[model samples]
Target: MKESVSYAPSRADFTGSPAVAASSASDGPSVKSLVAVTLGNGLEIYDFAVYSFFSVIIGHLFFPASNDYVSLLLAVATFGVGFIMRPLGSMVLGNYADRHGRKAAMTLIMGLMSLGVLMVAFAPTYKDVGIFAPIVLIAGRLLQGFSAGGEVGAATTWLMEAGGHSRRGVRVSWQMTSQGGAALLGAAMGAGLSHLLSDQQLYDWGWRVPFIFGLLIMPVGLYIRRQLPETHSTTAASTVANPALTLWREHRRALVLGILLVMKGTTTFYIIVYYMPAYMVNTLHMPASISYWISLTAALLTLLIPFWGGRLADRLPKRKPILIGCAIVSFLLIWPIFATILYGVPLGYTIALIAVDQILANISAVAMFLLVLETFPKAVRACGMAMVYAVGVSLFGGFAQFNVTWLLKVTNAPMAPAWYLMFCSVVSLAALVAWRERHHDE
Candidate 1:
C-alpha cells in the first residue's frame, strides 16, 4: 500500500562479516556491543512468544463458544487484540526509546510483558466469570501486545545501532533465537502437559499453569536486558525532532519499503508459529504432539539465522539476502505445510518438512531488523519502525488464523487454506520484489 523507496544503494560496509565493532562515543557501533544487545533482545522475544503456543488452550478456557471452530476464532481474536494494541504501545514506547534511552525502553517493555503474562495466568475462565472471562483475556493480550511492540524495535535497534561493522548479520540473528526458543519451550510444555491432563482437567485449569510459569521468565529477561548497554543517546536535539514527521519528509520511500518488507515477516510468523499448530491438529489429523514437537525442534535449530543473516547483511548487498530469501518464500508459500500431512506422511516426514520450511522462513526473516533500522536515520528510526511494523502486524499477521479458518469454511475444501497461504505468500513476495528502494546494497 505504501510507495517503494528511491535512493542510490549503499555499498557493503564490512568484510567477511566477523563480529562487528561498536560505535565509539566518538566512533559508531562495535561488534561486541551488538552481540550483547542482541542477546538481550532475544530474551525479550522469548518472553512474548510464549503466548502464541497456547492459543487453543486459551480458547477453551476463556472463549467458550458452543462450536469448536468459533471458540478457536475467538481465542485467536483475543490474541490478536494484543497484536492490535502493539502499534500504540510501539508509538509511545518507540518515542521513549528515541528520547530516553534504548536500555530503559527494553526494561520497561519487558516488565510490562511480564505483568501481562502474570495476569493471564491468574485470570478466571469463562466457566467462572461469564463474559468477563474473555474481557480479561483481551485486556491481558493488549498489555502484552503493547509491551512486545516496543521491545522488538528497541532491542533490535539496540543491536543494529551497536553493530557498527562486521557480523551485523550474526548479531541480528540472535533476535529470532528467542522466537524459536520460545516456541520450542512453550510447545514442549503445552503438548506434554496436554498429554498428561485429563481432557476435563486441561479444559478447566491445566492451561493457566504455563502462563503462570511464563511470568517467572520476566525478571530473568529484565535482568539480561538491564545488563545490556544503552546503544543510542536521546539528546534534546534528537528528542525534539518529530521522528514520524521526519521519516515522512526525508525517508518516505524507505519507510514504505520497510513496511512492505515487514509484512512478510509478520505473515510468515503467524502462518507458522500461530496458525500451523491448529491447522496441523485440526485439518491434517496429525497428532497435536507431532505438531508441537516439530515446532520445538525447528525453533531450536534456526536460532542461529539472525547471526548468519547479519553476516549477509554486512557482506553482500542487504538487498541480495533480503530479496533472495523472500523470493524463495514466495515459491514455498503456495503450498500449506500441512497439506501433505493429510496424506498420512510419516511423522518423520512431517517433522522434516516443517523444519525445512521454518529454516527458509528464518533465512528470509533474519535480515529485516537491521534492514529497517538502517532504512531510517537514528532520530526517526524508532517511529519509522514502529509505525510500519504496527500496521503490518495488525492487518496481515494478527488476523491470520481467522482469515485461514474462514477460507477453509467458505471453500468447504481441505486444500483451500493451503492455497490461501500461498496467495498471501505471493502477495508478500510481490511487495518485496516490486519495492522501489534504490539501495543497491542488495
Candidate 2:
C-alpha cells in the first residue's frame, strides 16, 4: 500500500546527499516555506471569513428583498453557492499539484483567489446594477470557493513534506492556525467597523473594505508563494495519468473515512466561528457590536488554542481515543450549553461556554487532521486530502449557516445549532471508530 519511496526527505538526508541538498536548497529556506504557506492560506480564509462576518450587510446591498429574513437567506445561499465549485477545483488543481509540483499549484491558486477577491471588492450594488449585482457577487464567491478548494490541500501537503515526518504535527497544525488567524483578523475588522460606522454606512460601503484590503495584500502573498521551492519529489515516478482516478481506484475507503472525519470539525467550525455573530444578533437579539466582540473573542481563542492541540497530537500514541472522548463530551454537553444560552446567561458565562465548545473542537480537529494525512501514501496525498476535504466541507460546512438560519426560522427552535452539532459528533465518532490507521511517523 505504500509508495515505493518516501516523498518527504528529511533535512539531514537532504544535506547528506549532494544532489538532494542542491535540490532542497532550491526549494527555498524553511522559514520562507512557512511564511509563504501561512500568508497565502491566511488570506484565502480571511476573505471567506470576512464575507460571512458581513453577510447581513451584503444581503442588504446585493440581495435586496422586501423581507429581512428572505434577504439574509438569499445572501447566505449565495455564500453556499461558492461550495458548488469546491469539488471541481480540488480535482483539477489537486491533480495538477500531484503531477507538477506543490509550488506551482500554490502559485496558481493565489492568482485565482486574488481574482475572486477583486470581483467581490468592487462589485456593484443591486440597486445600482439591478439583477446583475448578485450575479457578479455570486461569481466572485464561486471563484473564491474554487480557489479555496485546492488551497488547503496544496498548502497542507507542502507543509508536511517540507517539514518532514518528525515535524509533521506542528507543520500541519499551521494550516488550522492560519485559518484561525484569518478569522481573528476578520472578526477584529468586523468589530472595528461596527463600532465606528453607522448602520447606513456599513450597508452602503463598509462591507466592501475587507475584500479590497485582501486584494491589496494578494500580490505580496503571490510573490512569497512563487519563491517557494517545489516540495513534491521530482525523482519519484508515477505512471498514473490522473491522480483523482488513482485515488478513487486505490484509496476509496480512506476517502470516505476522511470525509466523515472532517464533518464534525467543519460543521462546528463554520457554526461557531462564522455563524455565531449573526446568531447573536438575529436570534438572541444581542447588539451587533457586542456580537462582533464576542466573535472576536472566539476567533482569538481559535488562533491561540490549536497550537496546544497540535502539540498534544504530537505527543499522543493514539489519536482515536482522545478524538472519541472529545466527540462524546461534545454530544453530552451541547444541549445543556445551548439551553443555558437560550435562558439568557450573563455575557461572561456566554463567552465561557463558547470557549468550551471551541477547545473541544480544536483538539479533535487537529487530531483528526493528522490521522487523515497519515491514512494515504505520498503518491496521492494532495488529491486525496483535497477531495475528501472539499466534499466534507461542501456538504456540511458550506451550507451550515444557511441551514441553521432556516432551522431557527422555520422551527422557532433556539437549540437548532446544538442539535446539529450533536448529530455531527455522533457521525464523526462513528467514523473515527471505523478508521484503520495504517501509517505513522517514521
Judging by lDDT against the true structure, name the best candidate: 2
Model 1, 1-442: lDDT tens per residue?
Answer: 2223322223323333223222322233444444444543444344445555566777777777788878776876676677778778777888788778888887888778777877778888888898988877777778888876776778766655653334445555666765666666666776677689887887677777777776775576677767776767766865645566666788777767666666656666667666666788887666675676665556666664544554455565545456656557555734635556667767777666666766666766666665566666677666667777776777777776677888888887877666766666666666666655432111
Question: Against the unseen true structure, what C-alpha lDDT does each candidate score?
Answer: 0.64, 0.77
1-442 per-residue lDDT for model 2 (tens digits): 4322223434633343222332344333465456567676688778777776788888988888899989887987887887899999999988888887888889999999988889889999999999999999999989988988888788888876775444455566667777778888876787688789998888878888888887888888789888887777644584246889998998898898889888888888788777876787888887876666556666677677766675566566566777888888777777866776678777777777778877887777777777776776766788888888999999988877778888888899888888888888888788888898766222
Top TM-score model: 2
lDDT of 1 at 58: 76
lDDT of 1: 0.64
Once fitted onto the true fold, the runs of candidate 2 whose alpha carbons sit more than 4 angstroms away are 1-32, 198-204, 234-236, 286-294, 409-411, 440-442
Report the lDDT of model 2 for residue 310. Answer: 59
Candidate 1's C-alpha runs over 4 A off are 1-57, 64-72, 126-131, 196-205, 286-294, 329-333, 336-354, 434-442
- Worst 10-residue lDDT window, candidate 2: 13-22
